[model samples]
Target: MQLTQSSSVEIPMNDAKEVDSVTLEPVDSQSGMDGGLKAWLTVVGGWIAGFCTFGAANSFGVYQALYTLEGTSSASNISWIGSLQLCLIFAMGILTGKLFDAGYFHHMQIAGMLLYVFSHFLLSP
Candidate 1:
């Protein structure tokens, strides 16, 4: 049974054949990888995202400090906010990358934008 994105893939590490089943065999790399407007835009978008995510990750220290100063909670409880942010970023990366591979780019992109805006809206309080 071929496992696809729509179908749950149960990969057993002990089974080499199952691992091989998941590998994407390369085909016509030039058709996709050759430089073009879309390729360059993707590179630019990736660079922007890399810089922004790095900045956001680093900004957790700032948030930690702010929370500490605000006296909203103890250091221990406040730390969970940053930890949750980091965890969600990693988890979403895994989910959304798979979605992108499965041709859900537009839906994921819009949902991401809405979620980002909603987060900011919630934080504004």
Candidate 2:
């Protein structure tokens, strides 16, 4: 009853006491996670991604300063922009983090990238 990447299954016939085992192959073969090429690439990529995300998160002060200089909005009202950005990031992280844990990483990654590009185009003047 145990299933693995290359495990087999046993089927018993109604009229016979013999059992037949059917070998199964995994749909996709994964690169080793034990310090393999994929693992190193993932580590590097994650570092870069973390750098970008945190870098943007930390730049909110610059944005708030600029907004305050503009005099078009109060400092408190301008603060909401940064607050909303962080809120969306953490909220989406919760949903996307679960998707990653559930092994829908590629699906989520594609959807996220598409959404990012689409939003850029949408919000651009």
| lDDT scores of the candidates, listed in order | 0.75, 0.74
* Model 2 worst lDDT run, 10 consecutive residues: 19-28
| Top candidate by lDDT | 1
lDDT of 2 by residue, 13-71 (tens): 56654645444555545653376787889999889867866676678788678768978
RMSD to native, candidate 1: 11.6
TM-score of each: 0.65, 0.59
RMSD of each: 11.6, 8.2
Mind sharing the TM-score for model 2? 0.59
Worst 10 residues of 1 by lDDT: 18-27
